[model samples]
Target chain A: MPVEKLIFYAFAALMLFAAVRVISVRNSVQAVLFLVLTFFCAAVLWMLAEAEFLAITLVLVYVGAVMVLFLFVVMMLDVDYAAMREGFARLLPFGIIVSLMFFGVLFYILRDRFFGPENLPPPPPHGADYSNVEALGEVLYTEYFYPFEIAAVLLLVAMVAAISLTFRGRQQRKGQQVSRQLQAQKSDRLKIVTMASESPRKATPEPAPTDPEEGQS
Target chain B: MDALLAVLLIIGKILLILIPLILAVAYTTFAERKLIGYMQMRIGPNRVGIRGWLQPIADVIKLLLKEIVIPSGASKGLFVIAPILFIAPSFAAWAVVPFDAGVVLADVNVGLLYLLAMTSIGVYGVIIAGWASNSKYAFLGSLRSAAQIISYEIAMGFALVAVLMAGGSMNLGEIVEAQSGGIWHWFFLPLLPILVVYWVSGVAETNRAPFDLPEGESEIVAGFHVEYAGMAFALFFLAEYANMILISVLTALFFFGGWLNPLQGIPGLETITAWIPGTIWLLLKAGFFLFLMIWLRATFPRYRYDQVMRLGWKIFIPVTLVWLFVLTLMIKGGLPPWFGEAG
Candidate 1:
């Protein structure tokens, strides 16, 4: 078999195994890790197909940034495993129906009706020095500019929504006014008030002001 | 036969990278300690060998001799896999790091993105190690580290995007080539703010102080790998140093002009510096950055966890984003003579 075929099969097998392990693992953290592995394996498969830009961006965006947050949540939350599993039975039928519907849509999309290799084979791989970044840039900025702009705006809205949903301004916690701190000078917060020694106020006779005898007297 | 030889050659190249990398990782730890020691007006680890040069090796043997300890309630598979997960991506990142002009293992088109991705993947080890250890300290450490790394990664990526805009390529070698000709030609001149931001974020990304909230000894008790021991612990240690080296190399490449002599613009000094090979210059520049990192560690106190987060999310991110925009404009305007070919 060709080396590329060997790599393809290897990555495909690993991805499948990891995909199964993602759901099967008892530990949520481990399950999340397995999901990461699945994503990574799929990226390798993309690499094998010479879609270097897509492959790297997948790992960069999903595996790198997004999944770190995913693992972060999974690792930190004290998930009650038994309680988590309790709703599985109730959700299973709905899950199955939804999954089946999704798969049906995918199948219909991939079938002879709209798309297949018979209809349109994948684009030929580019040689070295063929900058996929430039090609993608050109296409995104020109042909697909409207869709791209809409996607960017959608992401902006989602970002605003996420912040608004989760951000809570609390009065309890001490706030750092970074700008004020940066702007402060010694002269702004300090002043000299000279006084005559032993004139303004007399020292307390007893240093221990908290003495019960003194308070009572 | 040709295929076998090619495999052998690739293996040899990997070994060549590893041999130096391992040594550098080992020595970087020693250097950090010694530098900190001098800053504090004391000697560090002088007993092992002459002036503690062999201390890292001695430390290595000690770690190697210890038994790998697994906590009773820890997840077995992840416990074993965590260190490997941490170290592998870090070492793998060097594959695309150009040592000299045209001297890289994998000259991928999206080399910068590849490096960013590898760096991003490294946080998994900490997160996994924390979880697998089944300790609260480790878990907390992992969480802080995870949050810290991701926050800084945004700034780091934006900084690199600025570099990408100026260089007009994601390839590392091409980035270096664009900064060729003179010291003034370096991206550091025009993109000073981004350079500072990148290195600061680099420090945070490497989990070094003052951004080391995850490993805060006073609070977190070594943070994510609190329960790790023997080689398992050693891998985290190695990974941290390797990451430091990675950051240093990247800083050198991006801002300082990797493999380029500093006095390139001068008439006769250029010839004088040309006697030295490009690789040496690259290493020297990387070393300077490494020393700068250690100096910062020695000088500054550790940042409060909240402060670290604030710095990354609020300060660094906005600054880098603005600089990235300014960088695009600068390239378009052709304001800097050195950046004439950019954009």
Candidate 2:
């Protein structure tokens, strides 16, 4: 086998291990990290397959933005490991059966190409100078334009809905409106109050618990 | 056998790039101190070596000799890996940075995206470090860093899209080459506002001062790397400074025309400008940006956390989005001067 094939196999094995670890890991944070590893290895595989744009996008989007948020949320969650582990055995058979069934379906789809002579030959490879990004862009904008536009619209709707649902103001805590905070000029907060100077006269001569010198402050 | 030799050659090339990068980071720390010191009316780092030249080396040795104290409650594995993860992408992003014409490790077509991708990976280090530290300060710092990066990346991406639109290429080399005629032909001339947005976003993305909420020493105390000690802390320090330099280099590349002299036209001046090497021009531009960073730190007060958020999401996103739309219209309209290079 060529060195290329060796690298491919290494990536594949790493990806598989990471994917497994994603579910198998006891710690949620650990699980998410493993998932990131899975995404990273998958990106490398995509690189091997010569889909540089998609591969970089995978790293940029999934491993970068998405997983950071995932880790953020998972860390905030207070998980009871012992309680989670107690249910693991009960869920094992179901998990195994479901995964097995899914794999079986995948095998069923791929069996013809994998077992027999390659019925579907690989697509013609693009030249080194061919921009994967440009090709993908052309397809996304031209051929699948409608679906792409719809998907974009759907994401926009989801984003708006998420914001509206979660970002509404509540009366309980005096929430910091960042805009209000930022817009406030120093003049608004820092008032140079003019008053007559009194000779050591306290506003309230209440007895202090600790030090009498505190009243001067 | 040929492949083996090729791998060895590539490794050597990688080392060539990395050594300079490591040295750059070392000296950047020194420069930041000295520059800021000059601004603050204080003499900086004249002790270690001549004009504090060996301060970075001394700092490194000190950090190396210092004991790494892992917090008892901290997650061991992630704690160990966080600094490595944080620092790796800072170096890795340099692979696609075109120092001069045809001078890059991997001349991938999606070079810009590759840089973006690698830089994006920098957050993982902070997040992991914060998480593994098991300290509130670290966690808060990580969250802040993550949120800040994610929010700013959008504006930065849109700003870059404008650059791509103008340059008509995603490749860094081509982007620089496209702005070939002169400083006036540069993308920054056309996409000035977008460049500003991108620069600000870059500052925020790198977690620099005025937007350095992630490392709020007054409150969170070193932020994400709160629990890190010895070389781990050093790694984070290195990564931060590396990222600063990366941003500076990128600013030089994307907007200022990488490695290209400012004066391309106007007879008699061309002789003066042309003599300066392209690589030197690039370094000078990058250095200026680096100096600007230090200047900003000295000049501006650190922005409040919410203020930083407001600046990013509220102020910048809207500005960049509107600018992006305007550019798109210009391209469609075939407007001259406005829609010149990209359109």
Candidate 3:
């Protein structure tokens, strides 16, 4: 078999295994881990498809950041594994029927395409030394530049919205003023005032317990 | 048939080179300790062998003889596999590294990319090790390491991009050849900022001080390898040193003119002989940088985690980006003839 075919098979096998385990596993944490494995297998398949940049981005963005945050949430939550397992039989028949219907319809709709003849010719060799990253960059920046900028603006807006949502007004804590902090000077608190020396106090009064009950005791 | 036999013969030759290289890695620990000990005003491992020459061998034997202890509640399969995952890449990378002219085991076109891929794969070992141990400290250490490696890798990538721009190639041998003619022709002088950023990023990437927050001995308790014992710990140790050596070799290749004589135009030296092998020059340059790594490790304190991240992203990344643009301009205009070379 060719290397690409071999890689495809390997990734497909891993994806299948992880997908099965995602449903079969009793533990939710393990299911999430299986999901992560499925993502990883998909990434590997992307790599085998000559999408090097995409493959790495998938690993970095999804595996490195997304799955980590997922793991963090999973670890932090007080998940009731036993309770989650209950009512499974009650839900199974309906779940199976719905899943089968979805899968059957999806498969039926796509079967002709899946087993179809090679209608399209192989893409042109994309010029000598041209890479997918460069090609994508050229297309994104040239023809779709306005849309790209719009998408970026959308993302920026979303990011700001997210931050503002988290930024609540907490009155109790002391908030820092950047300008004041930066401009702080020692002279602001210091004073070299001259004063006449006073005589030391001869005696200091000591107070006893203030309550009349203490005096009676 | 002759071609096939020659290929087999070449394979045999590579194995011959590799066996000694592996042995050298073992002894590099001894060399590192002895050198560092001398620097720190102490005698290291005098009893291990005669004058401690065989200390690494003795240490290897000791580690081998020691019991492999898997902690209770640890994921046994993953825990056992982690060491192999860590060390395999360290050894595998030697295939692409050129010891001399046409002397590398594998001279693939995408050598640098292969190295990068291998290094990235190395993170899985740490992550798996941390998760398998079932200890919070180990897990936290691994997480920190994962984050550290990923963050610094970006900075490192930028630095390499500058070098790549200067050389116009990702092939390691081609990069080295482009630095030929003299030390001044090397990218380090023209691209000094990139060189500095690369070195700093390399230090962070390998988890060496003062960037070694992951394995801050006082804090994370040896980081991801906390639960590993005997041979397992040795594997992590070997991986760290191997990474250090790898980065040093890379620095030499990118900046210091790998396999090129620095003393190119010295009057009497030029007259004496020109028959010296290029690999010696490369090894010496790489060795000097390795020593510097150890010196920095001995002298510097580990940075706080936040500080490490800040330096990588907020400082190194910007500096590298600016210099990368500068380098691109210089290469486009063609730098002065004697820029990196100084007699």
Candidate 4:
């Protein structure tokens, strides 16, 4: 077998195994890690298929940023395994139905009529100088510009929504104003009052008549 | 046999890169110590060898000989894997780092992106180590480190985007070639703000001071690696140092014109310095940045956690974004001398 073929097979096998493990793992952290592995394997598969730009972007965006945040939240959560498992049996049938429906839809879309080799032959391979980034950028900027812009705007909106949802108004919180602190001058913090130096006073002897009444008492 | 020869040849090239890189990392530690020591009016580790030249070697041997102690309740598999996971990406990122003109392991078109991805993946090691250790200090340290890394990554990415816009290519070699004329033609002159953001973010990303709040000794003991000992702990140290060197090298490559002679445009100096190798120039540039890293460590106090976050998210990100906008305008308007031909 060709080296590429071998690599593809290995990554494919790993992806499948990781995907299975993601569902099967009891530990939330481990499950998230398995999912990450699955994504990584998928990215490698994409690389093998000569989609280097997409492959790296997938790793960069999903595995690097999104999944790190996912793992962060999952790791921090104090999950009750017993409570989580309680509804598994009750939800199994519903889950099976939903997944089956989803699979059926995918099958309908990806059936031989639409996606077979006869209908859609593989793309011709480009030369060594061919840049996936440039090609993708050309198409994205020219052909699908409006859609791309719309998607970007949608993401912006989502980001804004998330922030706004979480943002509490600045209640009378004592937050550090770093700029103000940095701009502070010596005079603002310390005032050196210039005064005449006080002369040391010698201890005076008490007069005998000052406490005459007390002594008499 | 031909295929086998090719594989061996590739392996040889990798070793050529890795050997020097590992040595550089080791020496960076030595340099950091000696430099910091000098700053504080003291000599560091002179007992190991002459002027402490063999200090890193001794440290390495000691670490190797020591037993890797696992905490009683620590997750065994992950505890072992975490350091490897962290160190692997730092090494892997070297694959695309060009030393001289066209001297790279894998000159992939998406080299910059690949580096970004690889570096970002390193946070997992810290997170995993923290979680597996089952120690509050470790967990808190990792969380802080990971959050810091993620925040800084955005600013770093934006800075790289500015570089990409200015250079007109993702290939590191191509980026260097674009700045061929002289130091004046380098992206650093036009993208000064971006360069500052990139270098600062790079420092933060590596968890170095003044951004080294992740390993804040006073607060979290040893941070994420609190439970780690011996070789395992050494791996984290290795990864951090390796990352520091990588960032320095990358800053050189992106801004200082990697492997390009700085005296190129100067008439007499150019001819005089012609005998000097490009790799040396690259090293010198990277070495200066490395010195700066240590210098900063010695000079500055560690940033408070909130301040570090504010600097990354509020300050650096916005700076990069504004600079990126300005760079885009410069590129579009064909601004003279630096970016006239960039469009």
Candidate 5:
């Protein structure tokens, strides 16, 4: 077998193993870690497909940022292991049936009739100094420019929406505007203290008795 | 038989070089201290090994003799692997960095790209160390480093692209060859903006002072390597210094003509220094840049996190990009007269 095929099989095996571990792991943190492994293996497969830039982006963006955030969330969450496992068995049969059905459908669609017996297509002889990123940039700008701009707009809109939703004013919590605070003069927080003279003497007064038949007046 | 013998010779040479390289890295620390100390009004190490020339060796012995204490909660395997991983790539990148016309160990077509990839992978070691240590400080430091490297990588790549455009090749040797003839032919004059951007990005890339927030002492408490000690800490230090040298070499190679005589338009001086070896010139140029780097570290203060990002994205990237476009146009049109009639 070719080296490419060996790498393909290795990465494929890694992905499957990682996916299985992700589902079966008791610890949520370990599950997220397994997911990262799965992403890494996928990135390797993408690299084998001659998508070096995309592969690196996947690692840098997804594995670097998304998985880190996932790990943070998973670690911070107060999860009860017993409670999480409560309905797992009850849901297993149906979940497996649904997943197996989806897998069968996917396999059937990707069978010999669909993909044919075509071997791995040999990559074109790359130019001496050509970069995948450069090619992608050219294509994106020339052909897909409008769609790219549209997608950017959509992302911007979504980002704005998310920020707005999360940034609602709350009456209970005190929030400081850093810009305003930075601009604040020291005089605003400062005060001058002065001492006044104290009174020299004070008198005590006796209380009149009123109880026990008017203090036997 | 010849190929086998050649391989053996190469391997032997690597071994010889590796031992000395390690020793050189050890003393580089001492040199840095003494140099910085001299620059300031302070006395550096003088007790160990005759004016502290052997201070690096003494320091190495001390680090080696010291016991490596593992934190109770740390991941033992990854914690051990991290420093080695970090240092290995730093040394590996030097494999392709040409010292002279034919002195490089490997001269692959994708030499520059390979360097980039190797340096990029270097971050994983840092990230792993931070994660494995399970320390908040380490984790924060690593996170900051990751962001910093990734952000500046874009600007650095742009700056490099400008160099590539000017040189018309990604091969370092070819780049050096292109800059032959004179100082005016150096890419620094034509691509001045890019050179500045590249140099600044190089500083950030090396995680040096002013951009060394990843290891900010006052804030994150020594940053990512907070937990590292003994030889492990030494390895990280070695990697950092090695990276600094690598960046300086790259700066020299790209902006200043690598191994080329700096006498352009001056007929007498050019002819005189034409006989001087290229390696010496290259070393001198690289050394000058290294000194400048140290000088910058000594002089400037660290930038805040936001400021670092702002400088990279807002200032460097756009500057490099526009300069790249300008250079591409200039090179495409024709060489300027000052480029000295193109060999």
Candidate 6:
């Protein structure tokens, strides 16, 4: 086989292993890490398919941002493994049925009858100067412009919703007013108070000492 | 046989970049020490051979000779793998960096995106190391570092978006070529605010001083790598320094014009400086940024954790977003500086 084929196979194998481990791993942290590995391998596979833009974006978005947050939460949570495992036996039948149904759907859609090489031949390779980013951008901006804009708006709305849901205004809560802090001047912080120096005190006359002789006697 | 030769050639090219990079990383540590020392009025690392030039080598040797002590409760596999993970992306990102005109390892079209992705991947090493160490300090440090990196990454991404708008290309080489005329044509002047945001966010992203709250020694006692010792610890150090160099080089590449001569338009100096190689110019710019990084470490105090977050999220992000808007207008309106420029 060619080098590209070999690479694809290697990454595909690794991705499969990682995907399996993501669910099977005993430790949640390890599971998350495995998921990251799976995403990375999938990205490599995408790169092999000449989808460099999509591949890099996948690594950039999913593996980079999303998975890091996932790992962050997973690592912080004080999960009880014993408690989590207690439901495994009870959930197994339902889980197996659901997974099987999902797999069947995927297999049916991906069957040779529809997605065979006869029906859809491999795309002709582009020349060296062909830019995946430019091509993708062209399509995204023109043909799918409305859909893209809608998706972006949807994400923005979701973000606003998330922020608003979490946000609360409390009178007692104190927070850093960064702008006010930055606006503070030296004069505002310090006042140079000047006062007249008064030092001299009036001298009082001393009484004559008569106790020394009497004490000695 | 042809395949073998090609593979060997690629390996040779990789080494050509990697060897110099590793050496540069080592010297950057020495430079940081010496620069910061001079700034603070102290003699830095003059004990080793010939004014302590051999200090980095000696330190490496010492680290290599010492044992990697894994803590009792530490996850052995992850503890071992964490340093590797940390350092791998630091080196891997170099694959996309344009040294001179057309002088790059990969030269991928999405080079900037690749660099961003690699840097993002680096946070995992810290998180894993902290978690695996089973120490509170390590975990806290990792959490802080991860959060800081994630927050700053958005600002950094926005800064790069401005660069993309100014340059009109994602390719680093193309971006450099876009600013070929002179210093006036560079992205720094037009994208001044963006550059500032990028530079600051770069520092924060790399977890350098002033933004080095993640490894705040006084508070977290060395943070995420607290339990790491010897070579394992050295790996993290190497990764940090490597990342610092990468960020500096990227700052040069994105804003200052990678491999492009600054004195291009100058009549007298242009011909005189033309003899100098592009690689040398690139290195000089990178070196200046590196020195500035050390200077920053010396000059500024570590920002409070909240302050760092506020600066990244509230300040830098807004600055970049506004600048990006301005940049978009410029690009659309065909204004001066980068107007009618090919990328």
Runs with alpha carbons beyond 4 Å of true place in candidate 6 = A193-217, B341-343
| Candidate 1 chain A least-lDDT 10 residues | A197-206
> Where does candidate 3 stray beyond 4 Å?
A1-11, A26-78, A83-117, A120-162, A168-217, B1-18, B105-110, B264-274, B337-343
Judge candidate 2 at residue B256 and give its lDDT.
Answer: 91
What lDDT does the true structure give each of the candidates? Answer: 0.89, 0.89, 0.78, 0.91, 0.80, 0.90
Clashing residue pairs for model 6: none
Q: Model 4's lDDT to the true fold?
A: 0.91
Worst 10 residues of 4 chain A by lDDT: A198-207
Q: Compose the digit string of candidate 3's lDDT tens values, residues A10-103.
A: 8899899999999898756567668877988988887666676677667656665566557556645788878888999999999999999999
Writing each residue's lDDT as its tens digit, candidate 1 over A1-217 gives 3778988999999999999999898978778878988999999998887778899999999999888888777666888989888999899999999999999989988898568567788787777989888989999999999999999999999999999899887668677788899899988999978876554333445565676765555
Candidate 3 displacement at residue B27 in angstroms: 2.1
TM-score winner between candidates 1 and 3? 1
In each prediction, how many residue pairs overlap at the backbone (N, C-alpha, C within less than 3 A)? 0, 0, 3, 0, 0, 0
Candidate 2 lDDT score relative to the true structure: 0.89
Q: Cα lDDT for residue B171, model 5?
A: 75
Give all TM-scores, in the order shown: 0.91, 0.91, 0.78, 0.94, 0.75, 0.94
lDDT by residue for model 6 (A60-172), tens: 99999999999988887999999888988899999999999999999999999999889999899988789999999999999999999999999999999999898885667
> Candidate 5: where are CA atoms >4 Å away?
A1-86, A113-217, B1-21, B102-110, B264-266, B321-325, B328-343
Model 1 CAPRI quality:
medium
lDDT of 2 by residue, B1-343 (tens): 9999999999998999888888999898888898888888998899987878999999989999999999999999999999999999999998898888998888889988888889899999999999899999999999999999999998999898888887789999999988887777777866888989999999999999989899988989989998999999999998888899999999999999999888886678988777787999999999999999888989999898877887888889899889988888877786665356445
The candidate with the higher DockQ, 1 or 4, is 4
**Model 5 chain B worst lDDT window (10 residues):** B334-343
Error of 6 at B153 (Å): 0.4
Question: Each candidate: RMSD to true structure?
Answer: 4.8, 5.2, 8.9, 4.5, 11.1, 4.5
Cα lDDT tens digits, model 2, A72-110, are 889889888887678878898999999999999999987
Clash pairs, candidate 3, are B184-B340, B184-B341, B185-B341
Which CAPRI level is candidate 2?
A: medium
Better candidate by TM-score, 5 or 6: 6
